[model samples]
Target: MMCNSASGSAAGFLLFTDVDGCLVNKNDYGFAPAVPVLRRLRTEGIPVVLASSKTGCELQHLAEQFELEPAPLICENGGEILWRESDGGNTRTVAGAERSKILRALNGLKPTFQFRSFADLELHGVMAATNLSEAEAIRALDRHSTEPLIWDDAPDRIPVFAEYLQEFGLTLTRGGRFWHVAGNASKGSAMDIVIQHYRSRLTTPVTTIAVGDSPIDQDMLDRADIPIAIPDPEGRFHVQVSSNGHRAGEAGSLGWAETMTRILDDVTGCD
Candidate 1:
């Protein structure tokens, strides 16, 4: 928990965060108590980038909820970047083709297996299955699916799957639900692109901080000057910042907000 020394110095700091496992709760309703800390950072002119596996449509909605004024967004597990225009107009998506290709591949593989997109499967709808464990689904997916598949869970699973793919000279990324199998495109790479976009506007180097809860976030976390992970009940990822073992705390987006607050406190010396 090392806080930044230059807190309140008026320097521009970029905070890159994941949406699903970091900011919003798993249910996608309200943010954790720590969310105000992030809001404080924003008020101080610190830039917070929402790097997530959420779609552009979802991210757009989230940006509104956070009152972010079109901050940089990383979607589809970091395969895409969305940004607001300088004139504060509509948000623009930058990774359409890659996302389409991955979706096309996943759809192509669906006939032989049980695969569905988050958009296609509502959490409490007819398609929702309480009987099926995610692990079982992942095992089935790994055994039968030829195309790369991703089941959302531990952050370590992405690297593990990446390593598994490397054995076959292939690679896969874990997005919200649909696994992405294609050329090299990841959250880390997307974050890099976003950083470059900010770099072009400034003379001083920007300090990058990324927060996430799963293996898919590892690359972005590795790239960040500071990386934080919220607690997971299963203890799958083992991040430095463990929540007070709230077995069923806010899971997805709300968890992200909780972690962001911790990071913001460190970055802004709010403690």
Candidate 2:
């Protein structure tokens, strides 16, 4: 069954967001400041689709927490897109190479690169490395299409390593905590997929607004009709993507709320 546009009209607005530094603060994992704005968006019939480097399992919980169920999720740095099926089951659309193949290629290069992959880090090890609770670590470890790893080799060798990965139809992306290896699919491509999915169902034009605060989010930002960047904890816009020549005034969820509020106001004339 098809869902109608969130706007309850011919036209709609969609929001794509990053998780760690945009909606939830890295230090406290709190999104209280964004709660009001999130409510407002929902009230205004905007679908808040979350696009993140997190796993599907992790995003599932977040989508629930934020009451965004039924919205498509872009997971593992755009390696996969997941959504709830009509029967309450889940459907996944993958865009990148399989995780096993990515791991196989990485293992072949183990002789030259010294890195520790998430698959090798078990639960407790991931907890120690990421400071996440056991449950969070488990959710984070659930991978479908990407492999995140810590590079133990010299920094200068990263470019060479990336080149090597490219030979196997893979690419490396830097994240907040680890470097990720996956197929060439990016957040920009994944967002396009989600947008197209909605467009096929909706009668009116959809306006996309993407928000994030990291280099990994550059692709998503590049794809948005309105790209909003949140400042880092230090109040500096850290994402390398173009924010449509604008930057949020604050950091974390506060900045997220402020920027979205301001942008939505400009876009829809909502107070």
Candidate 3:
């Protein structure tokens, strides 16, 4: 987390948020309850960026439908970034073996580990695993960088699977409810890029507020100027987070809205 200009304290803020369990209902993925706060942010000229383990395609669709279009998006757990502006958009993908190469490496495990990657799953399987609609599952299949795997939690042989993947420069991490495999990319890196973009564009330095609900968002949350941690549906946080930041009483979208409203009151300085 690079230090900003001295005047950053009085400057307005930019937001980098996670979608699944942070901005939306973890169980249903609906974000309607956060609408008023989202609209207020727009009115106050605060940029709301979506950073998530979901693919670029998923975030792109949400950016449009949720009225966050033209906003920068951190996708595939920061495996890729979509920076959109009024003129056009640009993408920066991290250096790593694409999922195809990683998949081949995993396939070398042969009959040892049954590969249950998102690529191999049928619509029903995707729906059952993610609780996403058919259309949403199709959007999820548009992944280009990381492979989201539904591992069966094999202990003894899991080390071997990880070792083989390391040979290909692939790293795996636990995400929402699945295992995400990718190269050396993270949400923090994407946040850095977005923060730099904001610094370059705005005359007044921008403060960043990051909100997340899970361990997957730790990198972004830790790096943000302000970090808000929303609890799980069971009203528990996945990791220790935001001791100084506000906590939402409820979970999911309501929690998201609850926290966002606080931010609006505390930061925006708008009536």
Candidate 4:
């Protein structure tokens, strides 16, 4: 909508992106291909918020690498929000039950379901499952409000498992890597809150560009003024992303760079 309106005249733009399969290539976990586009967006003064199912510790560390110091973060699939205040103080907003409670509920369902959660996998197992380094694995295991697990049960039973989770005030969603169980909070709601945080400080309307590569990011893409969908490495996409404003030319980091370069160029007339 902003692109159709007056892109150059918009007050500001907020870029909310999922980490895996969107910014970072899922295979290699590298984002070098997108670094140039990210740098361009940074130079244009756009704030890029990393929204992912990753733990706060993981997201915080990745944010530093992406140079998103003051940008807000939506972590654990929007179970938490972290940002820096104007006075250089850090603030955190948490949603849903804590990890312990979620794990307790999950433990109760273990007899009925066949799954291995991050808690069960521990550090070494998590590293093997995610192909992350020792330090990154440690960060991934430090979750706050969500439990990511590999579901070994029948695929048809996912709906029933979701129903069972509902009774415990939890829900299930699929991410690029694993299934995530979390509270009622979602990326869309978190985006709204962060947008409000921006609107309250700025005099002009802030345009939002949301990008992702899986069903986990559907809610976020639905809420964005401009939604960009990046396909998986095999060039496949989820069916729920019918409303996306732009579909990338490639998959993973290459696609991320491709679509974002176009959008930024179109919106800001920036080279």
Candidate 5:
């Protein structure tokens, strides 16, 4: 793990965090803990970017709630990278022929899988799965031997659901419970793009800290100088956090906040 020393006054540390599993609980509560922590980071002039499987619309709402200046938002499990308003209102989408090709191939394999584009689903709500329970959906996908993106209401089921999809050459990701099934695009890959963008604009080496909890968060966790998991007891992915707490049930967002504060203190030599 890379720790930023307080002895040197560098530009600032870049804090990359996931939304659903790391900062917000499955029920989307425990947002209070994150608000103050983020406020402190901003007061200290650190950059905190939200990188998640969330769509641009979802991320936009989160950014506003977090009081972020639209730091680079990574959406669709790294399939798209959008520079929030601060980075210029430029939104870079990674979906192109490759994504289209994958969709086409999947469609051919399972016609009843209800293939729909993100835009299409958002605008028309056509082909959306409105009747499937999380477990039922996964079972249905398994029976078909097809990996269809599922939109489950439960947040905790995402990791297991994603793992189950791997057998069918597909994976499940969430941008706030609207399950997204796509190719290998991941949050880590999108974070890489965000890091490179910042690196290009910097003269000094900047430290990157990625924090999340879930299988989808692994990519970003592995890419960070410091990876912090939010202490999910039900999580199948391995993560190392400084501490664990019980404020947010099994969701663990408050635990993540506590871990972040501890890690920052250690890095700053305040401990």
Candidate 6:
């Protein structure tokens, strides 16, 4: 059910977002430009759910900074969740694979493969790779289930890794800068679960809006009632069949706010 937002309209929207390259720049990772839209969303009581390859520590910190607490945030590209203010006590929303299992599978990979997961990257290495401060990188190192990997010079080796992961009932997904390894967890799958949860609580029909920049987000885009594809730093929109939904006016922070602001306006128009 869709409850009225602060606009008093009988419509509620659930926006699931990708944090990197979608909400913030992949290089610098600043979201100042999107602050206004974020504020408006909060004011309207619209739930802004983060679906990212980041860990719960990072997501929780970001959510707290945005005052978006009590909203479950999807992490590790949907392999795990940090449920907030929910009935059930932070259970893994599917993707129940253990961290040890994922690491063990990674160890089984051929030495020729240059794929390095977060588990391999020590704290200092994580800081260097992500450009996050020491504490921030430490938070990022905290993973529950899925493993984010950085594939080096061997692009051809990717398929082989995928094959091995499949044998172990795992899969690989390419995000903006890294690949995510998980079992039966995706942005789309997690969003579906969260959207259904929201619908169960609200009083009106729920409208889901999903936004992202990389191909990693294709499933989420397809699942959204309104899919918005933001351009990359090169200013190219890559989401397949994007014309069927919408492309943002710009890339990164500006595009995120632009598309979100427009959607918020349209929702308010329904009032």
Best candidate according to lDDT: 4
Clashes of each: 19, 0, 0, 0, 0, 3
Over 1-271, each residue of candidate 2 has an lDDT whose tens digit, in order, gives 2333345531478889998888888777899989988887877778888888899999988888987647889999999998866466898999988999998998899999899999888898888888899999999988989998998999999999999999999999887668999998888899999999999998888888888888888888887878888888878776755536357888788888888877766655444
Q: Output the number of the TM-score-best candidate.
A: 4
> What lDDT score belongs to each candidate, Candidate 1 first?
0.58, 0.84, 0.78, 0.86, 0.60, 0.81
Instruction: Indicate the residue-level lDDT of 2 in model 5.
Output: 51
Write down the TM-score for model 2.
0.91
Candidate 2: residue 137 lDDT (0-100): 96
**What TM-score does prediction 3 earn?**
0.88
TM-scores across all candidates?
A: 0.67, 0.91, 0.88, 0.93, 0.67, 0.91
Summarize candidate 1's per-residue lDDT along 12-34 as a digit string, tens digits: 67888776545755433446554
Give candidate 3 misplaced runs (Cα > 4 Å): 1-11, 87-96, 155-160
lDDT of 5 by residue, 1-271 (tens): 3545444543557888877667876553457776777776765566788876555555666677788765777765666676766645665666312445545555553433443444334322422343434532332232111122544235565565456546555655544345567666677767777888888887778788887776667667777777776655465434434333112233556766787777666656553
lDDT of 1 at 48: 77
Error of 6 at 13 (Å): 1.0
Error of 4 at 83 (Å): 0.8
List model 6 lDDT by residue over 1-271, tens digit each: 2334575752577888899888887888888888888887878877889989888889888887766636878888878877776453454554547777888888988465777788888898888888999999989888878888888856887898799899998888888888888877787888878888888898888988889888778999999888999898888877863555788888898889888877777677633
The positional error of residue 194 in candidate 6, measured at the CA in angstroms, is 0.7
Model 3 / residue 21 / CA error / Å = 0.8
Q: Which candidate do you rate higher for lDDT, 4 or 5?
A: 4
Q: Which stretches of candidate 1 lie over 4 Å from their true place?
A: 1-10, 91-100, 107-114, 117-171, 175-178, 181-183, 238-266, 269-271
lDDT of 5 at 241: 43
- lDDT per residue for candidate 4 within 8-61, as digits (tens), equals 543388999999998999989889988888787766678899999987788878
RMSD of 1: 8.0
Output the TM-score of candidate 6: 0.91
Worst 10 residues of 2 by lDDT: 1-10
RMSD of each: 8.0, 4.1, 4.5, 3.2, 8.2, 3.3
Candidate 2 residue pairs in backbone clash: none
Task: For candidate 5, give the lDDT.
Answer: 0.60
